[model samples]
Target: MTTTTSGPPAAVRSVSPRATVRLLGAWHTTGPAYAALADALRSAVLAGSLPVLTRLPSERELARALGVSRATTSAAYARLRDLGFATSRVGSGTVAALPRDASRHEVAAPPPAGDAPASDTPSADPTTPAADDTIDMSQATPSASRALHGAYTRALEALPAYLDGGGYAHLGVEPLRAAVAARYTARGVPTDPDQILVTTGAQQAIALLATTLVARTEHVVVESPTYVHALEAMRRTGARVVGVPVGDVEAIESVVRRTGARFVYLVPDFHNPTGRSLSADERRALADLVARHDVTVVGDETLTDVDLVGAGVPAPVVGDGTDPRLVAVGSASKSFWGGLRVGWVRADPQLVRRLAHTRQVLDVATPVLEQLAVTDLLEHRAAILPDRLAALRAQRDDLVDLLHERLPAWDVPRPDGGLCLWVGVGRPVGRALAAAAVTEGLRVSPGPLFTPDGSGQDRVRLTYTRPAGQYEPVVDRLRRAWERVGGR
Candidate 1:
């Protein structure tokens, strides 16, 4: 039943007819053979007798060897796929896999940093996650929506008055700040224009906070496998960043108390790598932590508006900006496009004034034209998000289907919101797979790249931000890459 990959030739193994019959018990006593066979396979998978990604017998091959009709065999395989216990790879055919366990949440925790995969494993030459002729799956950004094009057209119309001035808006363009503040008020967070300071992007907003809030060698509390850029920004400020896994607010609070962290950063809404949100209880607890500990909290809301189909809105961590200790960061990047490069920080007016002066040292001011465009986009966001959500929903489903059909061994969790899927490929070969994929012209980020302390070698993050048509070619390239890995 088991065929091992020997030294020279790592042969592709298919289940023998005899072994297939043995693995699956008699089905004649059940209502129907196909359904019964599918159930048996599921049992085997759950029992761990058949490890993930083990190739199954082909429909015709199994039918011929088992004396069953080909239609019956095909139905059995199809049923297995529908139930999530099996998936098909192009060359690999149907493979055994673990189904989604209802008891377990898809938003699993990042393992401890010391649990990193062994480094001595054999691999091809390392390839960058993105390069020429590669299907880029590294970054979690999407193209500018049609709303952005319209916003740009309107921005040009509003540009003349600002053009006559010196154009250095350290406090940002006034109208945009007012518009952004109004949006926050409408969302249950009342705000004032003076409390809003615009930056080039959310990344810049965080970068500025890294400088203003963090003193040298001070401790900063952050999510371990958070947005990689956020980790980098924390380090750039000479801060000793302590990381805790998501879903555990207590761990963060413990760190804050133990280290007397000057600032704590969290992406409570649609977190980047895992695409999960804090539970309502957790959010309330977080607000309490901010008040009781007298600690400054930075709430990153970049992915707040990107809530996927059927995933309802999460309670904002710092709603209405009422808490003096909380600073909220909002961005048009995730909702509209990164190319617009406009984001803002909502805090106390005095803090805003101080940061605005500090920001003057960074880049003087955000571009006035882009700020105007963002204002117009904010005006029409209600109309735009629904269409955008519908398209993204379809694209997410397509990517899931394609991944199941093309890379059967991979454990793909269905994320309810955000642009990316955090996946588990069934081996300690994320880096190797990514490198091989790049050689086959597909750019993918391995799991270890996201961890602050370098872990998660069996995981990969995939973005569904591109067009629907793009998924097909990407999966095709991935299939070829998987083939190359098996052949080696």
Candidate 2:
């Protein structure tokens, strides 16, 4: 006799309600514990689960809930504050602040049904990916925890003595400047400490340079499909950006001559997105053209060290000492950890001084702790290079192989170095593909994101920086999405 003893229909057996605070599944435990917590929260906010003005639990409550100490919660909140994600008043508990784009939300919605077959005619939703889409090969960043944390830890231990002062200045701590100069000196460019200006990151350095050098309506030459953020920076300064195809020295020269541009931004080593490096001849021609046109050259060498194929290319020489127009940008973010936020600009002493002054007004100074940490990494550079290079090479190879196997129709060029491969999808399906990828729980930077003029509609930049395990799943998704979109 099955006794129906339920008073309210056995209380209607149901699955447990999902947690309001969903921790990011992809977060790797590294760096500071507080940082991990902050990143998890940030991801949630970015993903739109935690909407703006949502009241977060108290520190004690969160600590207990997350199984962490209250101090950890406090530190995590502090990090959130630093990143502009939360705010606290004297009496009110911490509340969620909107991201830069306050109106954006990441509310979970059901994925769109598989779309119909792809045609040469463009779809209404250009960013939708096909149903069988597997890999999201769009981001261009290194995988987390490349073992540089050990170097950073060692660096931190040696930093106590240097923390004697108030630690606020725009020129950066002297030791870090010296260390950066030494790196350039080792790399064939003889640089002095005076010629180095420490910045928060390569992005900040680019912004400062743009602010100081670019005037409203002045023309700036950028490589087609150049670093998107850099292009944005140029636009922020109200500069007219003209794209010269990467590896086309003549095209760049013609633009420089025609526009009489004040500056030209070039990525000589493993150019972003495309991963094409300028040949020795092209670099020389670029330098000569800039010199003849009296235009400043901002050489971004952020991806200089991730060389996976053949002998590493030589750094571009911007002519003799008298040339005050060449500025080289370097960063520890790509080769090391992005959290370090330490980058330097190598230029003439006068120009460096000017940039330093501009930096003073903008950020006052980069944190001394991070600067010291990067300085230590630079001093022990030999110990870290081999591991970094090996990890990146493995990732690049894994991605390339996966793409070939699953995405045979996609034209994925094998990059010689850097963390990303620029893939051509044979048609202008990038927007559709990106939108579709997001529905499949993948986020990607569509090709048009990199182009200033919304061109490159057929290309996508895929990062090989995720874990090896992620490659197959991503590719599988891409394959499924492609098939659903009727891969030609």
Candidate 3:
């Protein structure tokens, strides 16, 4: 894996057959091999164990791995595709997904506010103990601000003037771009409209950058337990992803040095799942490292707007002029809503021009109305910020306190701003807990889902994005799941 050749290496995604067999542990065997296999695999996908968009092992490979006929593996995949749980693209083989959505092309909407889709929140808990009402603690997208309606209403008043045109602006409507740029300026980054290129959402923005920048076998740095979809985006680049502990400057710089990595991805503001912000000192040290190594840092500031506990998140790490290679990705998803599907990348004008061409292929342009709505939302953000902050803090505190009571063994952190808590369950039973969570009618993400190499088996990310009342039941269900998995 270390050796690098002249041109780009042949791009392919491969999963160990043994890993598949392990994921399918104790699968239902009463029926024919294919049917039982499909059902068991479906269970894993729904349980948040096997991520959506995971490449299924080859039929022959899986057949050998599971000691079944190749036809059984083939039939299972066919069934998955038929059930809409998988898809086959020309280059990508049969890929795992949830049943409802079939498009492997579009960025599935920020994994249901937090829970990665396909690997979903609606999926069953493995504990087999059903709650009165299913609670999805996987993804915690904030409910849209009360200001959204008025903003959009105002946007409509402003819409028709632009409606006179074909409604296709490759780089997004100028007003929205200006509004987003202004946002950066307010944040101390002093961004210009030309520096911002809006996309349907952060997912597409990430894909655009990955497609434009990453090459086969190139080393890409990621936080060990970061957003799952971001990890997937980097993997799509066909790069070797190196995971470093959050806030560990030395570890990150060492990888960049060793691998000669040019790109590094980070979520410095109220980091996803963990909800921790980088200290000013840490950010400065990291910025210096990227500047020295000449690495282009891609920072996800999607959750930057939602500062609940006031971690006093520092300025954008790859600040505008200090490191020209830095690209900032922000979203309307966390602060406002994922349904808005508005996100932007702040980069150099020349790069933005190149990305616009790359982005048009992903989605010709973000929907006109949504861009207006986002622009409107930003204009009214000050009116909405305080309440949103209050709601998030209340939920975060409640979730942290409850876990301490019910799952006392888990070392759940008190995240100041982000939507979720990355809980250390004190045992390496995250997979089993995730599987059991399905039966408990609670959707939760296991530790491996957040790991670059899928090794964090003792951790689970719990989002406080659900209703406050739901936390009690979530705790109850998690306790049941823990007990079911021998967590006594």
Candidate 3 residue runs with Cα over 4 Å from true position: 1-132, 320-322
Against the true structure, candidate 3 has what lDDT? 0.76
lDDT score for candidate 1 against the true structure: 0.74
The TM-scores of all predictions, comma-separated, are: 0.72, 0.72, 0.74
Please say which candidate is ahead in lDDT: 2 or 3.
3
Ranking by lDDT: 3, 1, 2
lDDT of 3 by residue, 38-71 (tens): 8777655544345454567777988998888888
lDDT of 2 at 87: 68
24-110 per-residue lDDT for model 1 (tens digits): 666454578788777666655543334344567788988887788988888988888777766775555676654555212122233
- Candidate ranking under TM-score, highest first, comes to 3, 1, 2
Give Cα distance to truth, residue 64, candidate 1, Å: 53
By summed lDDT, the worst window of 10 consecutive residues in model 2 runs over 8-17
Winning candidate number (lDDT): 3
What TM-score does prediction 2 earn? 0.72
The candidate scoring highest on TM-score is 3
Alpha carbon lDDT of each predicted model: 0.74, 0.70, 0.76
> Which of 1 and 3 is ahead in TM-score?
3
